[model samples]
Target: MMFGSRGKARFLAAVEGLESAVRDRDAKRCTRGLREIHRAYGKAGDQEIAEGGARLAALLPELPDGPRGGLAVFVGACVERGADARRCAPAVLAGLAQALEAAEEFCERWAASGGGDFPEPDDGDPGPGVVERGGHCAAFGWWTLPQWEMAAAAMLSHVEVRKELDSIVRARLLRDLRTVTEASGHDFKCLEQVLLVLDDEPLVALDRSSGAGYALRMTGLGDTFQLHTLLADVLIGGGHLPGQAPSAREAAVCRDAPGQVPTTGSFNLVAPDGSLLWNEGTPADIPVVDGVRLLVLDPPPYRRGWPAGRFFPNMPGDLVLERVLGAEETAQWFTQVAPAKG
Candidate 1:
């Protein structure tokens, strides 16, 4: 209620204003407004809002030169501002690792500015990217869209920025990452191997579990974690990222995840309460992700694109995880998963 009554109004209005400015091609006005929004974001105290604001600050540099050259300025400024290439610093990791591959392919469509850089590419036409920007989000930096959104949301929960800008930022990051990486590294992953995903995708909730949470592990990768550190390096032609992220032998591992993809798709995660877990690889014996209040997965079988399982309504379109996991296949794949036994 506090968010709605005080924060939501300004947040909604600012985003609407941004949309209008972008639509009208008012780059100057839009950039300025974004700057103000960033400052105001810090004042509000929401984790997402503050995090997104700093990212927006990174994006602002690209603006003065117009959208065409704005991104370069943004990246240049980010390097100067000290974005952490060695770690997944919330303020610095703009979802680059997840989107580096497609972003490079996508940036090829454009030509750069006075520096002879390739120009900016169109918002669409991403290459081999899994978390393509959607109509709902845009990015202000190079990390994953979901992480940025989560960061922004964290800030907003405290400060309240605007309507969830996850989709808006997702789209923007994909666009910028492409531009930033173009001509930087032909073999994106060869440079680094962190599987960063800028996901605007939704969770296919299988169950609406009671008192569910999630198990989130934000591992700090090693210097060998090239994917996360260098993929973006090749795209933007800046932030060389030291050719390695700080990693211990235990921290050094390949960027392998169930969501390793470069297609124009969204990343779907199940709520830790066992609401949704990809019916792949995960051992049921492993505990559920913490604080998972919901699950996400394919739609029901009766409908098009429905999951390969039996489903019942927990909240109309929503269902409890166990109900959907009734699929023998799902149950089999997940060794550690089971409905919360009362």
Candidate 2:
């Protein structure tokens, strides 16, 4: 809930240290991370209010063998201060559990590939695991929008700050982030990468057990907020996320672009009765209509940004929704995801 130049630096530096510590299997570095994080809170104010700092210290030791769980837990705890904990706690706990499970899955995959035991990085130079240009950490960092939102939510959970969760605040935050990153003189791309690693994109779930089911694409800050809202609805409100929740234009694009894209941009989106559902830069997954591949792109060859161009050139409409939702649910879902240019 507190913000300043120095405090922000301490927070981020501590996060970087914690990430490195987890990767290197170093308990001492973990302790150092806690100290730094605590100092960050202190610099913001005293971590005395809500006993947040102490709670965080206690929770840090319970972090899994990976950085993801601890980072998420820390953000959740920090954000929960003075919040309606009874309302948000369940979702926070469930989200943390999901993060831990995801990290465990990644570790298992790494181990299965005959990857040997983990070892510490070199004394002076952290290995590719640390944020480096064109490194594994860089790639993971790039798409971590989900994690950033978790942190942002925590920062904004307080009553006064929560009021600023709109476009203006987003623009300010993005600008401030850019300024801070520039001041730090780190690689902007790498920083961007690190900030976005917490996302759960291309996947939607009714509950934790659904195991990455369904497809959802989130493009910007508004979508990120929408995602948090949807998750809160599911986890806290006991509601269900619809199987297909595309924008209105997106639905039309889906209907029009089945199996082929006649034009490059929005010029070709025409519905069955000659309604134009034209929109640009809307994204969708591979469209499977009636058990047939309706839209497909030639899977691009492996190279830098290989899959970026592999999307079928057109946006499909509500066929996926028709397959997945009842008429009532479909109507409700459309109302919920009504197209907005945020």
Q: Best by TM-score, which number?
A: 1
Q: Which tens-of-lDDT digit does each residue in 1-342 have in candidate 2? A: 445666756765675676677668787887688668767764553333234433343344355424433454455555454423333433443443343333333334444545444322221322454323323432233223245345434543232333333445344444544543343333334223222322112322212122112233332211122223233233223323323233333223333333322221211222222222222212222222333212111111231111111022221111121123344533432332213221
Best by lDDT: 2
lDDT of 1 by residue, 290-313 (tens): 332233322223311111110110
Estimate candidate 1's alpha-carbon lDDT, on a 0 to 1 scale: 0.30
Which segments of model 1 are wrong by more than 4 Å? Answer: 1-12, 45-191, 196-342
Q: Which parts of model 2 are misplaced by more than 4 Å?
A: 1-49, 54-73, 81-145, 157-159, 164-169, 172-342
Model 2 clashes, total count: 16
lDDT of each: 0.30, 0.35
Error of 1 at 315 (Å): 32
Residue 303 miss distance in model 2 (angstroms): 46
